[model samples]
Target: MEKCNCRSILCTQMTSSGPHILPAVSSNSDSNLQKRYRCSLVEVIDVGVRYPPEWRKTLIMLLYAVLSTLLSSLVVVLVNNWVPAQEIVSPLPDLFPRSFGSSAWAFQLSEFCSFLLLTLWLIQWFLLRYKSIVGRRFFFILGTLHLYRTLTTYVTVLPVPSQYIICENKVSGGWEVILKQTFKLMSNGGFFLRRSPTFCGDYMYSGQAATLILTYMFIKTYSPDIFWVYQLFCWLLSVTGVVSIMFTHTHYTLDVIAAYFVTTRIFWWYHTLTNNQDIVVWKGICHGQETGNDAHG
Candidate 1:
C-alpha cells in the first residue's frame, strides 16, 4: 500500500508531487534519451508483467491464442453459412448508414489503420521480447482478449442485411484454414464442407472494431511513454473504424456497439481479476528485476 518513491525506472512512481507520467524524469533530460516504460495501471493489476522470465504465463497465453484463433475462424465459417434475421434490416438505421455509399474507402481505412497498429505492436513486442521486458506475457494477455472476442461472436446469430453484407473475397486455403476446419469439424459432429462461401452473414459483432479498440487498449495499458500520441491516434482509429463499419454496411449498428462494450469488459475484467488474486498469477511470477534504460518511444 506504500507509495513507491524509488528512482528505479522499472517501477511506477505515481503520487502527489510526481510528474504527470510514470518513470518521470526531469525535463532537462535529452528528448532522445530513452526512459524506462512502466505503466501504473498494469502494475496494480498484474505483477507478472513486470518480469520477463515468466514463461508460464506466456505459454498459457499462446495456448489460449491457438484456441481462440481456431474457434474464431470456425465461427466465421459457420456464421457465413447461417441465415440472418430477414425481418431485421437496418438495425438502428438512425445511428448507422452514416456514410453516403459503399465507397469501401472507410472499410479500407479501418483495415489499414488496424494493419498499421498491428505492425507497430509487433515491433514493440519484438523490442520487449529482446529486452526481456515481459513482452510474451503482454502478448498473452492480448491474445486472451482476442480469444474472448472470438468465442463470444457466436452467442447470437443476427445476420447483416443482404444489402449491407460485404463479401470477404479473400480465399484463404492454407494451414490456418485446414486447422480451423479441423476444429470446426471436431466441435461439430463431423459436419464437413459448408457449401456457402464464408463471407456474408458474419454479424452480431464487428471484428474490425474490436481489433482497433483492443489494439488501442493494449498500447494504452502497457506503453505509457507515448501516452498522448498513441492514445489520441488509437481513439481516432477506433472511432473511424466503428464509423467505417457502418459506412461500409459491413456490420449492423449493434455489432459495432457490442464489440466496444465486449472488448472493454474483457480488458477490464482480465486485469482486475489478475490484480485482485495473487494466486491466479502465482506460477507466472518471476523474481523482481530492474529494467534497463532501453525503452520504447
Candidate 2:
C-alpha cells in the first residue's frame, strides 16, 4: 500500500508541472509576437514619409528664364551677323505698298526690341520675389506692348488683301461693301470727334490701314508728292499706336492669355521643388483668371 501511494503522488506532481510548462511557453510566444508587430509598424511609417523644400523650386524657375533669354539672344545675334541684309525681305512692302522705309531698318529695329524685351523679362523673373503688385502690372503692360508690336509686323505681312481705298472694288452687294463704305467715311474725317480717328482701334478696324498710311508718307523711293503734306500726321499716328499699346490695358487681353500657361508652368515647377503651400493657392487663382480670360476671348 505504501508503494502504491508513493507512485500515485509522483504521477500527480508530473501532470501538474506539465500544465504549468505549457502556459509559460504560450506566454513567451505572445511576447515575441508583440515585439515583432511593433517593429513592423515603425518600419511601415518610416517608408511612407516624405520631405521637400520651396526655395529650390524658385531658383529653378529663375534659372530657366535666364537660360532661355540668353540662348534666344545668342541665336538672334548669330543670324543677324551671318546673313546679308539684302537677303532679308520685308514682308510689309510686298503685302501693302513698296513705299515703306528701308526694310533693313525694320528688321534691325525688331531685333533690338526683341533683345530689350527679353532682358526685361529676365529681370522680372529674377526679381519676382521682391516685386510689388504695381511693379508686376507695369511689366505686364510692357510685355503686352512688345507682343503687339511683334504681331503687328506679322499681321502687316499676312497675305490677306488690304482694306484700304486702293483695294476697294464696286461690289455693290454683301456686308463687305458696307464695311468698306464705313471705313472710307471714317478715314476721311466723317466719324466722331470731327477729325479722323488716329487710334489703334481705328487703324485695326481698317485692317492694315496704318501700314498703308505709313508706307505712303515715309517711303522715299516710290511715294508721290500727295503723301508729303500728311507726313507729320502719319508719324504722329504711328507713335501714338506704339505708345497706346504700352499704356492701355485693353490690348493686354492677349498677353494675359499667353502668360497664363507660361507663369503657371513656372510657378508649378517652383512650388514643386520648394514644397511651398502658401503661394501655390494664390498662383493657382491668378493662373485660373488668365485661363478664363483666354477661353472667353
Candidate 3:
C-alpha cells in the first residue's frame, strides 16, 4: 500500500462514542504506524481514552488556584488577628485525653503524608501525556474548594478546636506581621518546623483533608496503570493524614467531615457537568469539540 504523504499522523482512539482517528504527536519518526502504536499503548493499555492536553487551560487553572490560595492565606492572617486563641469543647477531643507530650508527632505525620501526596501529584504531572487536562481539572477543583473555604472560614470565626494546638501569638506590629504570617501559612500549610501551626481560626473545614482526598481521587480517576493495591495504599495514606489531623487537634471533627463532603461533591459535580455537553458553563473548558484534539499540548 502506498503511504499517504500527509503532514500529520493519525491514530485511532476509542472514546465513549466510538473509535475516532486523531492526530498523534511523535518526535522520533514520521511513520504513521509507529505513532499509532505508541498512542494505542497510551490510550488502550493505560488511560482507556485519549485526552489531549491543553497547556493553556492547565496554566490558567493553575493561576486560579494560586490566586485562591493566596486569598485564603490572607483571610487566615486577618481572621487570626480578630479571633483570640481559646480552645472550645468539642465532643471528639473531649472524649480523649489532652496529652501534648505524646501526640506531638501526629501533626508531623499528617504533614508528611500531605507532602508525599503533593510529590506524587507532581510526578504524575510529568509522567502523563494528557497531564494538562488532568492538571486543569485538578487545579480548578482545588481553586474552587479553597475559594469557598475563604467564605466559610471568615464569615463566623470559631474558637480554637484543640487545647494542644498552638496559635500564633497576636503581635503589636502592623501589616508586615500579617504579611509574614500569610506567607508562612501559604508556604507550608501554616506548619512551622513541622512542630507548631503558625495561624489559627480559619478552620470551618480542613484544608489538609481536602488536599489529601483530592490527590487520591485524581490519581484513581486519571491513572489506570496504577495497580489496585497502590490505589488502596493511597487511600490508606489519605485516611492516615485525616485521622492524624484529629489526633493532633488541628481541626475539629466537623471540619474534617465538611471537607470530605464538600471536596468529593465539588469534584464529581464539575466533572459531570464537563462530561455532559449540555452544560453551558463548562463548554469552554470541556473537550467535546473535535477542534480541541487537533492541537495536542
Candidate 4:
C-alpha cells in the first residue's frame, strides 16, 4: 500500500507536466507533429539567441575576419613604409583597357552594393530582428573570404593602373584610419583617386569583387523568402562589378577572374561544412534537402 501510494504521486506529477512529455502515437505523422510542437516551444524560449553549434568555431571565424583585416591593413602599411618600396605604377598588362575611364563609377557602384547589404544586415542586428543564428555563422565565413583575398594579394604582385590612381590611405596605424579615409574619399566622390606611392602591390586579387560576390551569397543564402528577387539582384550586381573592374581599369582581367573562382570555391566549401540536420534550408547556390527539416521554413 505504501509503495502503491508513492507510485501514484509520481504519476500525478508527471501527468500534470502535460503533453510536452509526448506519448507514443499510432503513426509517424503523429510523432512528427509532436516533435515539431516541442521544437516550436523551444524556439519561443530561445528566440534571438545567436549561439551557433560550436562556439569555438564561431570564435575562430570572427578572429579570421579581424586578423585578416589587420593583416590586409598591415600589407598596406608595409607597402607604404617598406625599404625599397615598389610604388612606381607598374601597370599590369590589361588585355581589356589601356587606361581607366574618366571616373571609376562602375567600381564605386560595386562598392555601394556591398556597403548597402552590410548596412541592411547591421540594421537587422540592431533592431533585434535577425533572421537566423546560421546567418551570423555565415557572416564569419564571409569574412574569411577577405582573408583569403588579402593573402592572395601579397602572394602575387600584379600591379594595376587603378592601384596607381587610388591614393595610399595608410592603414598601418589601424583599420579605423583606412576606413575613415575610404569613407572620406567615397563622400568626396572619388572611386579611384590619383596615383600615389602608398597604394600599390595589392593588385593580384581584387578585393572589391570578393566583397561584392560574398555579400551577394550571404543575402541569397539567408533570405529564402525572397530568394529569386535577391538572387537576380545580386547576380546582376556581381556581373556588373566584374565587368566594371575592366572598365575602371582597377584590376587585371586575371585578377577579377581569379577572384570569382576563389570566392565561389570557398563559398561551396563553406556550405558543405555548414549543411547539417539542424539547418532548415540549404538555400545557396549549392543546396540539399535534409530529412526531418523543413527547407521552406
Which lDDT tens digits does candidate 1 get at residues 130-247? 3333454455655665566556666666545445344444435775765566465445421112223235555656666777777777667667765688767767776776676677
lDDT of 4 by residue, 189-215 (tens): 222233333355566577767766766
What's model 1's lDDT at 74? 64
RMSD of every candidate to native, in Å, equals 15.8, 25.3, 12.0, 11.9
Candidate 2 lDDT by residue in tens digits, 186-292: 44422112221122221212212222222222222123457564444444544443333223222222333343344334434643544577677889999999999
| Candidate 4 TM-score, C-alpha based | 0.57
In terms of lDDT, the poorest run of 10 residues in model 4 is 4-13
Model 4: clashing residue pairs?
Answer: 164-195, 165-193, 165-195
Using TM-score as the yardstick, the better of models 2 and 4 is: 4
Error of 4 at 78 (Å): 1.6
Best candidate (score: lDDT): 3
Assess every candidate by TM-score. 0.58, 0.22, 0.70, 0.57
Off by over 4 Å in 2: 1-53, 86-91, 94-297
lDDT of each: 0.58, 0.33, 0.75, 0.56
On the 0 to 100 scale, the lDDT of residue 25 in model 1 is: 46
Error of 2 at 267 (Å): 11
Kindly indicate the candidate among 2 and 3 with the higher lDDT. Answer: 3
Q: Candidate 3's residue-wise lDDT over 1-297, tens digit each?
A: 223234444556566797787665445556655533324334224557666667888899999999999999889888877776464333245333355323767878988888887787788667978778878888999999989999999997877766666777775588897778777777875432363545778788888889989999987887676478777878888899888887776677778889999999999998887787667745665654545676753
- Rank ordering of all candidates by TM-score, starting from the highest: 3, 1, 4, 2
Tell me the lDDT of candidate 4: 0.56
TM-score of 1: 0.58
For model 2, which pairs clash? Answer: 53-274, 54-274
